[model samples]
Target chain A: MSSFDRNDRPLVDVRHLKQYFNITVGPLRTKALKAVDDVSFSIRSGETLGLVGESGCGKTTVGRSILHLYQPTGGEVEFEGRLIKTKSDINELRKKATMVFQDPYSSLNPRMTVSDIIGEPLDIHKMYANKAERMERILELMDRVGLNSEHASRYAHEFSGGQRQRIGIARALALRPEFIVCDEPVSALDVSIQAQVINMFVELQEQMGLTYLFIAHDILVVRHISDRIAVMYLGKMVELADASVIYDQPLHPYTRSLMSAVPQPDPKVARANKRIVLSGDIPSPLNAPSGCPFRTRCPHAAPCCAEAMPEFKEVESGHFVACHRVNEL
Target chain B: MNKRFTMHIDVDAFLPATDEEKAYMVQMRPSSTFFRDGVKRLLKNKVATVSLIIILIITLSSLIIPAFWPYSYESMLGVRPGKSVDASFNNLSPFEYGETEQARIAAGETVFPHIFGTDSSGRDYFIRVIYGTRISLAVGFFASLIVLIIGMTIGSIAGYCGGKVDLIIMRFVDMIYSLPDMLMVILLATVLKQTLAPVLEGTSLARIGVNIISLFVVFGVLYWVSMSRLIRGQILSLREQEYVLAAKAAGAKGGWIIRKHLLPNCISVVVISTALQIPSAIFTESFLSFVGLGVNAPMPSLGSLASDALNGLSSYPYRMVIPAVVISLIVLSLNLFGDGLRDAFDPKLRT
Candidate 1:
């Protein structure tokens, strides 16, 4: 959104991305766990794309697959219009793109000092010419993330959750990456600290002209950061639109229910809001309902809705939905 | 500032923070690394501290005492080339003077008292005990070191690679596991002794003996399985840590990730396992020595000394007691100290 030409090609384009993990069900029998099935989306350069869903809906898988952290079982990921296919391409992609993991405790190497953890990316890419230059860059990164330079030599365990997350952000920023996949970077923090980290992400994006694929289950957080939002259910994307349009005029039944579920802060708005609580728990992806994975829970389900999967198609200029009854609803 | 509310806005309070204020707000803790923290915790444990001290005393004595001792480890005090053995020197009890030594004392000369007395050979039993300690301690440490190097390498490779590599390496480990442990050690020791004797005959290594080298070979071949399995399990879990993934995301290679992230996380396991391994390695060396596969004759390993003491047991039980007590003390102190180190460095046990 920050001065990216509206007509320029998207910085990242995912076409029919599929990620399936094989699990041994028995001694010789194996079954595929379709973690992300036929998900497709695109994010313009200098824009934030928010991916939202409940747990186990493959939102995180989509982020990881784009980074080639998990080799996608099928389809293509295009970065700067180049197909990310070869090992070297993935390595090249890694330099320009990075990720901020979900759990701060598990994300930073526990044995490393704060300086080493933040300097790891620099060391990996050979970014600095000399030791003093490396130290200078490390101090700059730490300051950007609001960490005290004095904390450099201390191990990660000495810091609180918020501070550890700052260290993670510092590492992600060390390579000066253009694209970052933030996999619930703030969900692990307290609500008060979450705001600080999210604001820092925004500030960094503006400062560095960075692009982000922000994946989270927290709808409010996604709404706050995303220029455009995509909703996924059971490894399939249900809707995609501008953040405000999705929140205000959701078309798909699942997206409608998800939107209604957001709590209204004011008593008057709370009384006026109609909460569309779904009937059953989300079915496991391993045995997700055939045709439309959401058909079993869709209130507007018909015989036709269960016979063939709905195609995710654009109805308006920028809004997309995948429901057979988009016209009727 | 209270500008958002209908109240007095303190513009001074809303001013940007200064360097002095930020520095004051930092409240930084003293810088500490993982090793320093582990050591700090280790010193707080009394049992571990005492055990560590006892090990130091024993190790220092074994290393330093032989340099200045009066009698050589193998020199027989009373035998000459053209003369018969001085019969009284052959089996002198503790502090007892031999026939020639008594004559020397009567002639205003001096002889050092045998603290553990003479064995059947008439060599100074005290020096033999000291040399035996040196051999035992050396074997214990060197064997464990070999196991650590081999096991850590194989384990990290197998664990980080996973899949087919993991399957093949793990099967090989299992195959080694199925072998009869004691039989393998004895068989390898005998075979190594036979093969290495001629090759080592003229080398400086001849002083260390073929049997000790065989003991090391046995440990390298068989004893590493447990350490490998331990490190493999540690790596298997640690490789899944997000830091490893983060490194991978930063385009770091598998070897780099294993070295920078996986191995460092499991250092506690390595230290603790190696410490525990020393005692067992020492015990194995002694057991092999007891069965006549220990260090060569005249070298005086604790097990070989004890084995020789069997010939004089009825007349001199203390010879048996002395070497046996030394072995037991070494193993005991090592075991206790290893436990202390584990308690100190283990992440779960960190205070």
Candidate 2:
């Protein structure tokens, strides 16, 4: 599975990434909460891989771990063919890979002016010749993100949510990164403004030849921008396929149920669509089930499902699923 | 591939008529820094503005008036070399003339009237009050500065470096908090006065008195706990903000992040806390001075003057009333100003 032809090298390759948070449940009792367990994926250059999951399914953790925002408890992240194993390697990777956080309100420093917030990365890297050059570059970035030069001196709180997200994007783009983990960048935005911000993201990618690990819970939003989509169940990846393939013909029962839940715009299609609501709450990661983490809630659970976890294996070209009943289906 | 969709519309109609109109489309408000904006809001608050003015007037008079005043705070008005003390000059009421001054007035020689009366020692009461205001204001400001420096340093360090460092510093803070503040202050002041008197002898600080030095020491030792705790709480919350993470992700070092991100975000809290601390420091200094542990004799603090007036309280009550009113006025103004600063500068209170 480590085969990458010279012509198709991935920008970021995360293999067997595990992030287990040791939470104190009681006095002197610590339990490991596996937030992202054995999650493996690769993002090709100039492409977007949408990571879709429920709120606690570790989609955000996957993005953060790849960026080394949260140190992974196990496994490796390779950036542009170099294995990131040390602090320096991670720091080097940060120059080329960045993140746009979910909440624009909380993500930006309220005291910082727009220019200072955006120019921070450049200042950190010492990328400019002088103050004049730095200001010019910041203004150029503001213009690229459709912000006026006059907005440069204004603080983050003075802007609307969409505008603040634009400031965040400008900050991310300051280093001229090749890859960015857009962690639900538009989730907190209004429906009317979400499309506009998403469109700007798409335009930025096109202009800069950037790759994105776009993590979002909204499947429809993910499908709109993602070339490939991966669905996670609990802390594990359940399905990986091309966006169109996953939407048109979902193989895993969980993926099928997820697709069925997206409300169709057409009244006839909406009336015809079936909703598959899973039973029982998502089990706590501390006390996860023995075999498959999702087995208890799976509709097609079998005796074999309780014995061992299903291997995430490729079923067809460019499509993968982890299910005990995949062959029978 | 060669097809050109030519849809002709009225493009000229939408164009601006003049360059000014074009510029108007993107006009922006002139930019201002946080400090300037805070000042703008503060100036709009009438009560705080008036209080600030009063404080300024008092401070300026204290600094400038003593230089040109007709009588010295420490000199007896009618005492001279080789002459018996002129008892009639002592305790002259406000706007009253002594025997010598009245004789000079009868001789058609102009005599300066005693303003706010002479003290029992025959020193000018007005000059003493002015000097007292100066000392109290100076102590309040300097003590607050010392507290700010100590508290901000310890708080940021402990908050940023959590776990063992935080625990140790916090326990130390708790120990300080549990101690009886006033009793400790009084004890420290008394002990420090005895020790500092010899060390400060013949130095300029000796003129300010050993008691004032001990009062400052007491403040330095006891008054910084609240400030440190407040700053520590602020830094704890601010260090977790995503901007701090973003700064870290951008390769900022710990000190750099603390300086550029953490401290600035909680600057409103710092300003408000420092402002509020001043009045408490002033009140504490006055209270200590009232108990005879403030500035040395011959240097009247407002509290010491009130203490002295207690001897003649039945006969001349205004002496006590005057200094008490001044102390209340100064503390009340500072507190109201601090409230206004919180209202104006605090981001949490902003719309």
Stretches of candidate 1 off by over 4 Å are A1-7, B1-26, B31-34, B80-88, B349-351
Model 1 alpha-carbon miss at residue A269, Å: 2.6
Q: List the candidate 2 regions with Cα displacement exceeding 4 Å.
A: A1-6, A265-275, B1-47, B81-86, B98-100, B197-208, B344-351
Q: Write the per-residue lDDT of candidate 1 for residues B172-239, one digit (tens) a residue.
A: 99999999999999999999999999999989888888889889989999988888899999999988
> After best superposition, candidate 2 residue A51: deviation in angstroms?
1.0
DockQ of each: 0.64, 0.44
Worst 10 residues of 1 chain A by lDDT: A1-10
- For candidate 2, the docking band is acceptable
Write candidate 1's Cα lDDT for A1-329 as tens digits: 34443445788999999999998889999899999999888989889999999999999999999999999999999999999999999989999999999999999887899999999989988999999999999999999999989788888988999999999999999999989999999999999999999999988988898999999989999999999999999999999999999999999999999999998889899899999989999998888888899999988899998888999999998898889999999
What's the number of clashes in each of the models? 0, 0
- Candidate 1, residue B270: how far the Cα is off, in Å: 1.9
lDDT score of residue A63 within candidate 2? 87
Considering every candidate listed, which one attains the maximal lDDT?
1
